[model samples]
Target: MKALILKRYGSLQNVMFEDISKPVIAPDEILVEIHAAGLNPIDYMIPKGIFKPILKFNMPATLGSDLAGVVVEVGSKVTRFKAGDKVFASIFDLGKGSLAEYAAVPEFAAALKPDNLSFAEAASVPMVGLTSWQALVVRAQTRAGHKVFIPAGSGGIGTFAIQLAQRLGATVGTTTSTSNMEWVRTLGADEVVDYKKQNFEDVMQGYDTVLGTVRGDALEKALRILKPKSKIVSLIGPPDGAFASRRGMNLLMRIVFSLLSRRIIRLAKQQDTHYSFLFVQPNGEHLAIIGSMLESGQIRPVIDRIFSFENAKLGLEYLETGRAKGKVVIELKDTTI
Candidate 1:
């Protein structure tokens, strides 16, 4: 099997397209002939050793997090699905190996693909869908009539968040460039802030929750945009109380971050608001529910582009631009069932 393997942790140049042994299914797993795979920021970050401390990436890694495909063989314990069953899932929890012709995924982390979607569409659902679902529904307890603000509304998670938040009856507001303003409104955002032309913090106020996918000062600005006692969920790093001590960091830098985070933590306590730094978790059950919602027309997959398997590098480059309106996928050409 040919896979995009990372023999060393460095830049994207370290990634090599080479033949590797196909994965054998575990007793509780299923072998999937991957039809498409979705790219996420973590896919690139993990291989570059940037998340080395927290994510614990092993050398010679294969980098992909979400996939949609058909089950070629199911283990004896896999009663929910069998050969020829179509499925889609976040393979992030199973380890990063979805950037290949096949992957052996644990049965519980995979779900039946929605009947209404193509493989590319289904592949777009797993990681960002899980992120949107967890942040809006689980963590923030978004309910009907609630007001929510999601940043980067036309991007992968924002696209899903806008739809899911609206489905739960929350009046959603999102920030995007002028080019994507109408796009997000179609996704159900009640109001769209043109970030390039207007500052969202200046115009938008009083939100039950805010999902921030931005970094630097923009991330700090998101905290100010929320109402008192309201929640803010950050997908980027450096939020209050998110302490992950790295090994053998210079004492000076450690002390500086500790004091800075402590001050932010204190501020969060004073406002009576909660803060959470989110990394999505895997759940086949959640994907099944999302799939049902997709089939019902309550949600839709937002795909930016689909590249042929040989052009997977171009997919990664496009995602790196931070301007994709939605998920980008790499499509494979194996048609056998």
Candidate 2:
């Protein structure tokens, strides 16, 4: 099996293409022959050690989460899929990632890929799709007539979130560069603020929820646009105590996160709005629903570019530029047995 393995956490130079043993599966898992892998900020962040404290990984680990491929083998307890099934998933197990020829995924995290999508397109959906679903549906409880604001409307998560929010009956608002304003509008954002020309905080107001993919001052500006009792879900964050407790971090780490998020949490409280961090998790059921939506044309993937597996490093570099209009993917040759 060939994989993009990280020998140590540091620069991109730490990553190497190497032959590794095929992944072994547990009773509740499936072995997927990956055909394509999606690249996200976390792909680079992991190797840079940015998430070391929360998502510690062993040396020589693979570095990807979203994948689309065929199931080569299913564990004893697996019931939803079998050999030859086309599936996709965002695997959360940091050790067994999708940037390899084969990956072992929990059965509950793998869903049948939509009939209408190619492997590359399906691979681009899992992480960003689930992030939008989790932030808007699970966390914010967005419903019809609600106003939802999403920053970076042309990026991976924003592209998906805008469409999903509109599908859920929310009036979607988003920020993008002037060049991408008309493009993002096709995704159904009711209000498109050209961030390069106008500030989103000044133009948008009275939102029921704000999905924050950009943090720091961008997140603060988002906070100011919300009405009282609104919710802001941040994906980039100084995570809150609840997140630390959910991940079952040590007391010291928990305290660290508590102190890290204290100021924002207090600010949110003072404004009578709620702020919480979201870490998207994998769920086969949710992916299944999203797949159905794709099948029905309720949501469409926006792919910025596709790189060959050999150029996976370049794909990550492109994503880091913060210029991709949508998702970037790495396509692998299919060699399923």
Candidate 3:
């Protein structure tokens, strides 16, 4: 089958289409005939070797993570799905990718795609969904009456997270361009800061949780917005010692992460807030719950565009420009090259 493969790390120039053997499933995995794939910021970042130290992929490896498709075959131990089942999944850290004719998905990380969502929309949910769930609900413990701040309301994670945070019953605040302020408000954000006109830290304050998505010193400024004892979970991170520990890195790597995050940790401590870095993990059960929300209309996908499978690199280029209002996706078919 023809698939997108990474020949080297550095730039998208390294990624191209090539013929590769179709995947053979393990006892706990299922083979999917991919129809669509989601492009997250991380998808572009990987070519720059951002996760080289963590994920183990061989040379000329396939490139992608989130996919929506039909199950063509199930593993011997798989019971949740069978041939011809519609499913969506995040294949991150699973030693495979979805920008291909087919991909092997672990049964534990695949969920029935919501009947209401097309394959393109379903493909767009995994990374952002898991990120929001792990950050707001699992780590920050956002609840009714809590004030939650999530910056970057126009981005993929931002759009989904705003809705999820509101559903979790937190008052959500977010930052976007002037044009998107009202757009984000429609997504349930209580406070929308037009970043071109207002510095968020100047006016926003007293939050119970902060989901850090923007890079640079924004996370630092966010500290002042939180009440004492609030929680901050950063997806864009100078990863902390805890993250390194969880990844089971060597002592040197843990020390390196500790050094890198020392200032942020110290600042959080002084402000009486807890700071932690989160790398979203794939979970089928959580996707099932998120799927229910999609089915019920409590949440809807915010898709900026859908590119053809052949134009995935162009889609990645467009997404990297930081202009997309929501998620970008790539659509394919069983007959696609």
lDDT of 1 at 239: 29
Per-model RMSD to reference: 3.1, 1.6, 1.8
Alpha-carbon lDDT, every model:
0.82, 0.91, 0.93
**In model 3, where is the ten-residue run with the lowest total lDDT?**
328-337
Against the true structure, what is each candidate's TM-score? 0.92, 0.98, 0.98
Candidate 3 ranges with C-alpha deviation above 4 Å = 334-337
Candidate 1 lDDT for residue 43: 77
Q: Residues 108-176, candidate 1, lDDT per residue (tens digit)? A: 889999888889899988999998888888889999878898888988888988999999999998889
Clashing pairs in 3: none
Q: Mind giving the per-residue lDDT tens digits that candidate 3 earns over 97-116? A: 99999999999999999998
Question: Which regions of candidate 2 are displaced past 4 Å?
Answer: 334-337
Question: Candidates sorted by lDDT, descending order?
Answer: 3, 2, 1
Stretches off by above 4 angstroms in model 1 are 239-263, 334-337
Q: How accurate is candidate 2 locally (lDDT)?
A: 0.91
